[model samples]
Target: MDFRKLLLVDDEEGVRRFLGLSLMDLGYEVKTASNGREALAVFEEFQPNIVFTDIKMPVMDGIELLRIIKEKSPDTEVVMITGHGDLDLAIESLKFDASDFITKPINNDVLEVSLERARERFTMKCALREHTENLERLVEEKTSRIVELERQNAACQVVNGLSSALESASREVETGSGLFNELPCLVSIHNRYLEIVAHNTLFEERLGNHVGDNSFDIYSDRTSPGNACPVQRTFQTGKGQRSRETFLGKDGEEIPVTVYTAPIPNKDGEIELVLDISVDMSEVTRLKDELFATRYKYQRLFDEAPCYITVQDADLAIVEANRLFKRDFGEVEGHFCFEAYKHRSEPCEGCLVDKTLLDGEARQRETVVTTLSGERKHMLVQSAPLHDASGRVIQAMELSTDITEIRRLQDHLTSLGIMLGSMSHGVKGMLTSLDGGIYRLESGLKKGDAERVDAATKTLKAMIGRVKKMVLDILYYAKSRELETEAVDAAAFLRETAAVGAAKAASAGVEFVEDVPEGLGEIKADTAALSAALVNFLENGVDACEGRGADGGGRLSLSARREGDNLVVTIADNGMGMDRETREKIFTLFFSSKGKRGTGIGLFISNQTIEQHGGAIAVDSAPHKGTTFTITLPRGPAR
Candidate 1:
């Protein structure tokens, strides 16, 4: 691989030289800039693959430097160094897709880790860009040839047939990019038995075209598709379906997509093949919202919805107001939700709608509303999060049902739906993993290949064992299954956990470590539940490590020891750690930092399971700093 072309931007000469040398020590070809203005000048000539800049600088600040560099060379990874007080500004830099950031007075380890992550991002960006360029060129060449052939034949049908033949040939050029793969969406075709038949560019790059992986598993977010996956729903119902869904991308980021699936039925009206299509709606959502705001401004029920309905964004800027909302609250469009509804210049205290935006979940509360007629009415309000195609909450729809007339009222109740969603994500992964092994085993069996079958068998056994454990845990929690607490050796337990996670880490090019003193004393614990809890922690850490960056081997470790009468276990990783906001709700149901990649159940389940064992989970983390999760369990046996 070519050396990473790096650029350093800082007003202070010592700061630039110091950081520049540090990168050079890591085998990078470094370039230095005195300020953002100089950095831009060097950038045009040096074309740096990665950049490190101080947030504060002369002529141009790091944020401006980031904006310019991205506007021009978006593929270049930029890392910012900011002070503690500039934390919020640094976060805003990330919105511009900054690779990573570090605090001022940076620790060498943290800086190195940040650079390593930037390296990984740079690699992926280059690969995707190259793949796209190659595809475009190939399409052009083939298209020109087809045009030449069409000119030689004046027959329209012949030209059309030849043109289509070119497309078919183009589709067969490679598994990653198809003739139509350049289209603004992920497209694929699958056969019966859930096997992927073919796929396009974005599909292959984002989600590998692993030939035999089950479609249900590949497309589903959680253990089960749960009616959210268009492909699964279509296959089951033998009908076309369109909806929104989230898929995990390369590096484990969540990709929100709008999906459409249709079945290609045989002559007897029997489905033999299915077509899957998904589009990234980030660039299109604003247009969609605009269209909805105009076209549906007077939607049929807007004048008739029994409740007050309001649509607003994060700033509480009212996007649209229903007829009832208008009459009761006065023409509120183009005004703040709070100003219109509560007559307050600032947002209402404990704003439930605002909370929905923060975590991308629904919120409900009973509030008293005053009408223009000077009457107070009791209303049960529900604010549902409206997410963009990328799964980030962008807006919310508030619906308030009037309950003033009712003499008796029931308490609002919410189910643990997030738990079920997360379980489905886990199940989805296990299904595909086991399917891959099964495919290899079956293929080997047909060819009378013992070695292949033997290897596949091992894989199948391990994956199936994991699935069985998860199933048992769910069943036990449901009812009737016996729970047995036993004396488990600390070293052996941690070693096994490390072993379970090693393969995953290796696959992602991450380093997995286990450190537990031999003969570290046994602890009384519910073997299954505790094991499941710890494994969840391990898996999450592994995932975060991968997302942070596999460059320089993303590090994850498991360590355990006995603390007096308490057994303490720690799972730590130098991965994309959480911000304070993210950390606060990680234990909440459906709270996922991984976007669509997380079902938000792992930490929640881990917390619940640990608490059940008379234990507590503590966390130490910051964005890009890494996270350490410590689990403290009582040493005594069952009561």
Candidate 2:
């Protein structure tokens, strides 16, 4: 039914002619050759869709012809014709891409069925090839469309970027123009040729027709050009200029003008324009005249002021000094007050200047200074930072009052109060140790055993040691004993203290770590006093850890290092820390966290000793997190 031509190959002429006639009757154009060689020549000339040949021939065989036909036209189908004795040979030809085989005397029904099958196969192959070509064309079109879309997207992005840039530039120009119009002073802009290009409302109202012309022609009617016009000077030098002048307004009244002119640069870093601003100075001039008439009164009050006053910039450079400041601390100009009077290159350890600037408020601090003349002065210094209109700190004013004699009297009174408050606790601790020793001795005498007596003797010695330490703390607080200062190794002292507390920490199920750097150089101080202060801090850490371990275990850390010229000792514990109010009051006398177990004099005594050494103690703590007490002691003795 396909009307497709077929190739029937065999050596028999009779079979070929019959098949060719049969295909022609079936409405297919047909051709035939007797042997395989003739069939190949006829096949090429006819370009038939099917071929019929004999199995055995003179020059070429059916199998050889089958191979050649397929090589030339793969779409053509081959049907081999064979005799009864050559059936095996025809069957073997199927291996050569043969379509089908027939017997010697071909059955007309079977032969026609084979031809129809070959035509159906050829029709399917042509349909598949056409489908493949269509798919290839579709793929090419889709790929081209994707490339075009990508190119368009890139072009749109460039346009969008340019649009955003133009919008931003327009906004900036509008903001700058608005600010120039709203300013209270007279403002004008001039191009490189010295022609006025823009004038604000205030400038036009005051000067009338005089503006928009050269500044020299407008202001030089009564005075020389250089003396009257500051804008001309700024244009000539390409630098900023400021001066004062008297100008007659439109109402025929004279007004003082303080003019300031500056150059505006172009893209090439060259001054291509100038901006001039003029401020009316009538009120300022009137105030100055009034102050000039009362100068004597101000001079008298300045010299008789009680407090020393000095003006300094943010860098602490002195700009002005009052009479009292010069008289008391020597003339201090072009030098910082601390370096001039205290003779130090840097500020004191706990500087108040930083605090004032950070909080933007007045700060007060009390410090001691040993002047160049060997005079020790204690002063209460109060300073306030001065801010510009933009809220930027530019300068500071400092006032210092001599408080040496006053602080001495206050310290004497404070010492008396501390002694009275601590007397009961101090006396009780000593008596308790003394009583324990007496009781142990009495018990040993009654037992009458040599071993018991020896053990009791050691107990008595330990009790006596406790009593001696309490007496020393009391005497030190009262300043009743002279300090025995010496150079002591800080690292060695820290190791010894950690060893004593490590056992206690282990008993409480807490880990204790000692991180002391070895070979830390010695610091000049009273060895016994320094050791006592460090031990007190360690004891507090141990107590805090024990309290925290009442519920679960925590950690205790003791570390020491020589940081620059100071020796730093830190004791930290993971325990219930104090609140802000409690931390602030910890150094005060009679303040205790351990109600009955603590005498409250440990930290108080430590605070007094640290201050006497010209050192500092600070505590950083947070509730439920922990507390760390850092003690910093100077490497040298106090002045």
Candidate 3:
């Protein structure tokens, strides 16, 4: 039936049932798994062409499965299923070569699009494989033919060169010259009667002087024209003759040799004499070995090139990949270059290969690509056209050089410069405010005004607090410190942090509410860091409420509870909320909604602290509405 095989994996049975049915309806022969562990077992047995797996599952996660599957079968397409809050994980799966991702409450249109893309990729891969196999076979055939031709040409050159030299020597001999004595190989001249009328010194030394002897008489096989030697055959056929023969040497040994003969014609085009040349068999064998070794050396150099090299067809399908490319990206030949190198659904825009193929011109560009191990690399990719015998572009060769470390160092230096610039302004403003507070305090004390002195004391205390917080934030950003974790009652910790937030809210005329319940379970985290991070969120909530003004019914609340193996905390405020742009940048370093009143370091530090404890924060807010931050932390400390 040509049925397409698909494996559907999820921890939930209900999801598997519904998704499997949907897949079957779409013409797939589907198998289901409850988790990644089971999915792998099913995968090995079923060998499905496509797999749909949930990102979060028991035993093993989809990201791990994706990596394993890609290692085992780079051609298999894996699509990740995830929840709305797992967008980051979904994006991560793509780095491991996931075909595509679908969120919870999967849309039919999206699923269909993902499936179609998978099918297209699979089909293209199959076609590429077939084409590559055929090309390799053709190349092997052509190589064998070329080697044989070269060997023949080498032997023919030796014979023709010697024959031509011997012909010249014969003319010299006719002129009573002694040039015939210097020829390298066994050479002689024979007449129509097959008589060796003349012989070179090499022939006389090896086969003994045979002038006036029948040419066939020197050969171990033939002794007369009835059973002709190469010399007799050349005269009989009126053409050149080449054959293997055994020569009777002076020592009476049967020496194997290659005999070549060419008839020497007179001016009237009548054959008057035949030139003979014989090379030792061992010499021919050496020439063949040299040809083979030279070819092998070239092949080794191609395979061991430092950068990743691939030969691609006009379609951009990889026809060949070098050893290093195969080692890192798996056996990716017969796949599209974009899919294998960049893990993309289609060719990259302004692809170098495409441009090179079109114009027969070399091209180069810098691009970022993800490796099979999920590491991102910056590569300098260059492509050159490969032409056929007719000078038409048939394929393109692409070379990629890894420049990841270089790019990383450059990015780090740029970020450091920007951070220092931002910190200087914030520190300067805080120092200016501290100086103003000191001047106010001195004036109030010198005037002996009790009310003015009290006001000055409060201003000085507030300014000092801000300055102290700014210093701590700078220190935290300057270096990373390990967490010293300990277990603490979640309810008690939440209440203690809430008391401080509540007092601050009261002073600002903003109502504060606490929903911390007893027995909320224990959480393992760095107590000081976790407390400060949570307090930062609460204080921000209080500020939001105070900014909304008292008449706006400003209110802030703190709540915490245990959810499964994690502690879930919520800090919400019915106050001045934020737009999408502000919300997105809230946790970014040096990004703040408040202008002069904020240093833009509190939320950034809080976010870092939460992440260090293996926690996640989700915020939901709308302009003029309200804001809620949902923080989820594991019950146990990070491993």
Candidate 4:
């Protein structure tokens, strides 16, 4: 139970404190003091519900303390403590409005009864205070609503009778009389007969008076043909309306203005007059034109920017794309940014655009893109956040710089470096052969030995042919290429490839030959590409055969035949074959096994050409067991 508080006071500590325990037992929070002066100080700070003070205490007796407390807080009930048989003091305390008398041989029963009475009164006082505050808050809310209603009604009254000054002297609005003259606006009022009864001084100064003329005739005569007169329409609809109108002023100048009309009702709640207010809108119209000019200026800049710019919404959908972005990405609006720019079914992993929106921070990433029309581009993408008023990201702006050509040039340079590394030894060996041939030819010319001269010439011719093939391979890898195909006899094609490989194989003392079936059918192929691809395979086989030791006895051969719907060509070499690692990476571009004698891109480019002809190539090789490369091509239309 929550307790009410009690204060006990007497000259002797024994009686006052002894009374405190009794009051506490009766469920009162008790504070005890030795005298009335001490009791008054405790009461001021504690604000106990009941104070019991003795009339004969030494400092400022009970009667005077009771008077002071009742004056300061009339609700705090004070009780007097009297000695046994001290009837007169108790009766005197009652005059000061003391709550109840307690005899100080301090009876516990009397204290309990007195304290309970004070608690009842305190609880009632608290309830009344809360009720009063609630009532005041409700009154304030109602007053605010009523004030807003009155303000709206006052505006309606002023707008309905704005130009009543010339109607009837008694019909003029009292409050708006001074406002009407001070405001700079066009104002007119017409009676139910549709005849103009009044006009503002400003209106009269600019458009002339129309005191007895009809409203429709006043505007219709000056109106640009088809537009309805705003004032006449108000009478027809019996409701207010607004429209833009241009008038021929008294000065003979066209003045553009926006007209507002309101219906005025009399005591019978029927339409009585139509009030027209027109405001000159020439300045607003000029500002709107300027705004459009500014937007047009920036729009031109955005469209013609050198870099690609795209505006994306919160969902990462491309909402707007500038001219450059549209030109490169091909009409990306209404598509998700990743789908439009990256051609991805889902968003790109670790997409910086998504990160920028989530954190409201700008981000940048470099990416490779294949466009809608199959052009590949490399872009440096920069995404920045566009935020709303509360600092939440609403959209993201991406600016992409095209680095496609630059990236292509870099790839070309890298391929060139790998090419130089792969073929340096081959070129060096060929140069040595050319130097020896020239030395032998010069020696033969001095000694008159035609046999030595002719042999040197053959060696030089063979080295030149091999070096020229390497140069062609380099040229093919350097550019974007297309195939030139023609119908050719399969046997004739195999014979050509063998003739080219025979010279290189002879230099290494290996047997190089082709086994094409006599009745092989004609096939459609890019002859140059097909020959180049077949030469690469034959050269690799010869090179593998030469890698064997002098006593190992090497052989390289090519065999071709038709198998079902495919042309199967197999090149085999009985020499040093490849291990598992080399076989796996044999066709990988820039991967070489011949130290400095192999151009790693030769096999790679060959595989690409064969695949373009709707073909596939497979390699079977094992260490010291020799290697076989099989090429399969469909005997169908070219890719």
CA-lDDT, candidates in order: 0.78, 0.73, 0.85, 0.79
User: Candidate 1 on 435-490: residue-level lDDT in tens?
Assistant: 99999999999999999999899999878866775665455444523347888886
Tens-digit lDDT string for candidate 2 (210-277):
54566654342434454546666777787889887766666767768787887665544466666777
Q: In terms of TM-score, which candidate is strongest?
A: 4
- Ordered list by lDDT, greatest first: 3, 4, 1, 2
Off by over 4 Å in 3: 1-307, 313-317, 323-349, 357-361, 368-379, 385-395, 402-423, 445-454, 478-486, 492-515, 548-555, 622-626, 637-639
How do the predictions measure up, each by TM-score? Answer: 0.30, 0.33, 0.53, 0.55
C-alpha lDDT of candidate 2 relative to the true structure: 0.73
Candidate 1 residue 151 Cα shift, in angstroms, is 99
Candidate ordering by TM-score (highest first) = 4, 3, 2, 1
Model 2 residue 373 CA deviation (Å) reads: 17
Pairs of residues clashing in candidate 1: 222-424, 222-425, 223-424, 223-425, 224-424
Report the lDDT of model 2 for residue 551.
Answer: 47
